[model samples]
Target: MICYFSGTGNSMWVAQTVSERFRDNRLTDMADAVVSSNNLNFSLTEDERLGFVFPVHSWGIPWIVRKFINRMTIDNYSNQLIYCILTCGDDSGLTNKMLLKLFRRKGWQCRHIYSVQMPNTYVVFPGFDADPAELEQKKTAEAVPTLEKIMAAIVSDSPIDCYLQKGQQFLKSRIIYPLFCRFAMSSKPFRTTDKCIGCGVCVKNCPTHNIRLENGRPVWANNCTQCLSCLHRCPQTAIEYGKESIGKGRYYYGKRKDSQQ
Candidate 1:
């Protein structure tokens, strides 16, 4: 089974590609699993493999993914080969190390871990924006070879721990990541501009169900994960994350069809 949480379709596309390479691989959305109780339990077959695919948030796992792991119950006995495919804009820091502890608590050994750099999507901060059209196209094209290599290793059951572009393990993950989780996840910064048509896209796409439409406007709850889905997926380019995202570009993968190239 490949369980994943994707805000803008980068991780989802990776998960779908990997799932298609194998037979009878179940795809579970971590966001939906956390909200729906019935989707949390899983019993993997003897031959089945387990995988976690998600985007790195603030150089760590997204809070929504952590929430799902904390709540879900997996009813399998033996130590099966578990792997993770992390999607990131640039470097992932020690996000893989953090994930290792999560599976350790459950007595599951995470055998292989890998990170792939996709287009940049986090734009709530200064000096961070989506990749340019050329760079975005480059990353998308480059990911195909990396993914193929990862799939080859998985097929052979090779123990690979290639976390490419993992920068500053101690400083980024151990120090900065915790602070980011504590103070950077506020939903109060989000607001719709005059371009908003109240189409309910943001309401429906929010992973945590933390958005609702009221009086033809989207209202945000305090439980946002800062996934940037609402900001990027807005059809009318309505959502903004404070002053930082005023003139920044929006990206949701499908918005650029060349991403699939």
Candidate 2:
């Protein structure tokens, strides 16, 4: 079983690519898998390999993914080999290490952790503008060959167990993560314009389902994941986090060639 959490579809694409190489594979988005507070369903046999795919945020796992992992109930699977694939915009140093430690605490024997680079979608960073169409093309071209190698590695059952030892060292010395979180959480909220068509595409694409329509305008709920799916998917360009997002280019995982009403 391959369980994934994707905000803007980078991790989704990676999960789909990896699942295509296996038989009897089960692919599930984390949001759809977790319903009630106490009940969760993961259809995996004792012999099946369990895989998790997700994007790294704030040098760690997304808060929702962390919560899901903590709440998951799985027993009687002694031979399960857990593998994790982390998709990131740049270096994923130390992120995998922290995840492995967390999984160890949960009694899961993690066999492998792989990091892959996807197009950077965190547009709030300084000088972070890129042509969305060109970036997608470049990512597709780069991902095909990289994914092929990953598939081959999986088939051969190779050992790829290099940990991010430097992450701990850097975190202790620089205090960078704390500063980043402070800034990220303090950013101004996004607002919707009158031009919003209320098609609900942004609501559907939000990983955290943070956006809701109020009086026909999009309103961000409190528990936002800050994955930027809503701001990027607005067809009318009606969503804006601040003046910064205004007039900035938008991106989508799949081609936007389809017509919009």
Candidate 3:
């Protein structure tokens, strides 16, 4: 089984590609249940090969990913060979190390861990987001080969230090990630422009159900994960995080689609 959480098309595309490479592979979206309600637990099939494909958020696993692992309950997980594929924008900081712990706590071990550097998607923060045209093209081009390598590695059950592995920067990732989780996840800053047509695209894409159409407008809740799914996928480009994001590039799979509904 391949379980994944995708904010944009990047992770979803990767997850689908991986599922194609394996037989009897069922692609389970962890967000479907999470978005419907806050229920994080998932029951697993007995003795099936297990795989996870998710985006790296702030150099670590997204908080929802962590919660899913914590709440997950499965029968006979010990016989499953767990493979993890992390699609990261830049460097993944000690994410493998963190996952090792999570798997161990769940009484399962990751047999193969891999990282693929996909296009950057975290566009809410300044400088930490968006890439130039040339650079974006370069990253996406490089990802094709990287994805192939990940497919080969998982199929062969090869466990090696990935090419993109870098220093964990424990202080920043361990300290700052949680701090961001605590303070930066507020949805209060989101604003909808007059361009909003209330097509309900944001509500459909939100992983946390933190967005809702109220009186023909989208309302933001404090439970937002800052995944930017609503903002990045807004068809009318009607969503912004504050005055700072007014002119900021709205990024999805490397380009901005038309804002017209």
Candidate 4:
């Protein structure tokens, strides 16, 4: 089974690509699992490998992903090969270590870990915006080779160790990540502009279901994980995260005609 939580489609693309590599595989969306009342339980077949794919948030995992992990339960007893794929805009701090600790607590051994750099989708903070067209194309293009390596590692019998593009582990993960979780995540700044046409795109694309239509405009709830899917996916480009995103560019993984596998 492959469990994933994607905000702006980068991780979703990775998850889907990996799932297609196998003839028989199950795909679960962690965000949907969290919102659903169904129990987070699954029985892995002997031949099926367990995998987790998600985007790196603030150099760490998203709050929704953490919540899902806390409630998740795998029924099978034997230790199957568990793998992880993390998609990031730049670097994933010690997010892999944090995930490993979570797995250990759940009595699961993670055999392989891989991180892929995708186009930047986070643009709420100052000095952070979507990558330029060339850079975005380059990152997406480069991800193909990295994903190929991940697929190869997953099928291998020998245990594949972790490989992470962890930059400033102590500062980003230990210090900055905690701070970001505490203070950075909120939906207060989300608001629709005059350009908003009551399209309901944001409401539908929100992974956490944090947006809703009210009087022909979108209203944000407190459950937002700051995924920026609503802001990036808006067709009119009318959503803004306060003044910081006023003139900033938006980005979400859109498959191009010439995109390579």
Overall lDDT per candidate, in order of appearance:
0.86, 0.70, 0.77, 0.86
Candidate 2 Cα misplacement greater than 4 A, ranges: 34-37, 41-43, 131-135, 161-174, 178-188, 256-261
Q: Give the TM-score of candidate 2.
A: 0.85
lDDT computed for candidate 2: 0.70
Model 4, span 233-256: residue lDDT tens? 898999998998988887888844
Each prediction's total of clashing residue pairs, residues at least 3 apart in sequence or on different chains, is 0, 0, 0, 0
In candidate 4, which residue pairs clash? none
All models, RMSD in angstroms: 2.0, 3.4, 2.7, 2.3
lDDT string, candidate 2, 1-261, tens digits: 888988777888889888987763587677555532456535467678888888877566766677778777676667577788887765565667677778888777776787776776677555765356666677666877776666566667685643333335467323654465446643246888788888888877777666777777777766666778787778888887777676667765664444442
Measured with C-alpha atoms, the lDDT of residue 52 in candidate 3 is 80
Clashing pairs in 2: none
lDDT of 3 by residue, 1-261 (tens): 888888877788788888877764677777665555566444566666788888888778888777777776675555667888888877887788889999888788777888888777777777665677677778878888888887787777776666465675787579877788788877888999999999999998887777888999999887676778898889899998886576676667734333332
Instruction: Give the CA lDDT, 0 to 100, for residue 154 in model 2.
Output: 63
Candidate 1 is scored at a TM of 0.94
